[model samples]
Target: MNIRPMEYVNRERINRSKQLIFLEPEQKIQDISMRSGFEHPSYFCTVFKRLEGMTPEQFKKSHGFGI
Candidate 1:
């Protein structure tokens, strides 16, 4: 399957963010977004929602993180 480079990168970022959410429950969403290589937290949330069907914060809550 062919994927756009941006799409692949966003997917990877989202995956990394997911791991961070699970492993670093105390980390802030902004920090996680930066650690995941997103320059801006707003864009990170946008891409995350597009790929995961939820914002990072929502994902964290749904996954029982930062509760």
Candidate 2:
């Protein structure tokens, strides 16, 4: 089953989370989840990976701390 409204919200939320991931690499994924409108951290991880093409940790490690 597909949900149009939910999909739209999901996309918007994913974009915001991507920004958070870039702007706050020091923050843990759970923090990002809470800040980005997600109540569940594990669910955030799953959805984030699906949309962003990589896990949050991998994104941070790839571009964080000057490397």
Candidate 3:
């Protein structure tokens, strides 16, 4: 792959998190981060916002999965 190893991991982590976002709409970001293989929720949110253009909370709300 052309991407760096960390980049690949980050993308995979984000992808996994996205699935959880839809599957567990009511789940908290911290829990979602943990379930998605992230060691820290804050880092997960940071990457999520960077890639998706919105925080996980925002993404969830935007998709009608959260309040």
User: Top lDDT: which candidate number?
Assistant: 1
Candidate 2 residue lDDT tens string, 1-67: 4768877787788888879878877777899888889999998888878887887777777776332
Off by over 4 Å in 1: none
Of 1 and 2, the candidate ahead on TM-score is 1
lDDT (Cα) of model 3: 0.89
In candidate 1, which residue pairs get closer than 3 Å at backbone N, Cα or C atoms, i.e. clash? Answer: none
lDDT of 3 by residue, 1-67 (tens): 8989998899899999999889888888899999988899999989888888999988888888854
Quote each prediction's TM-score: 0.92, 0.79, 0.92
lDDT of 1: 0.90
RMSD of each: 1.1, 3.1, 1.0
Query: Candidates' lDDT values, in order?
Result: 0.90, 0.79, 0.89
What lDDT score is found at residue 30 in candidate 3?
A: 93
Q: What is the alpha-carbon lDDT of model 2 when measured against the actual structure?
A: 0.79
Can you tell me which runs of candidate 3 are displaced by over 4 Å?
none
Q: Candidate 3: how large is its RMSD?
A: 1.0
Of candidates 3 and 2, the better by TM-score: 3
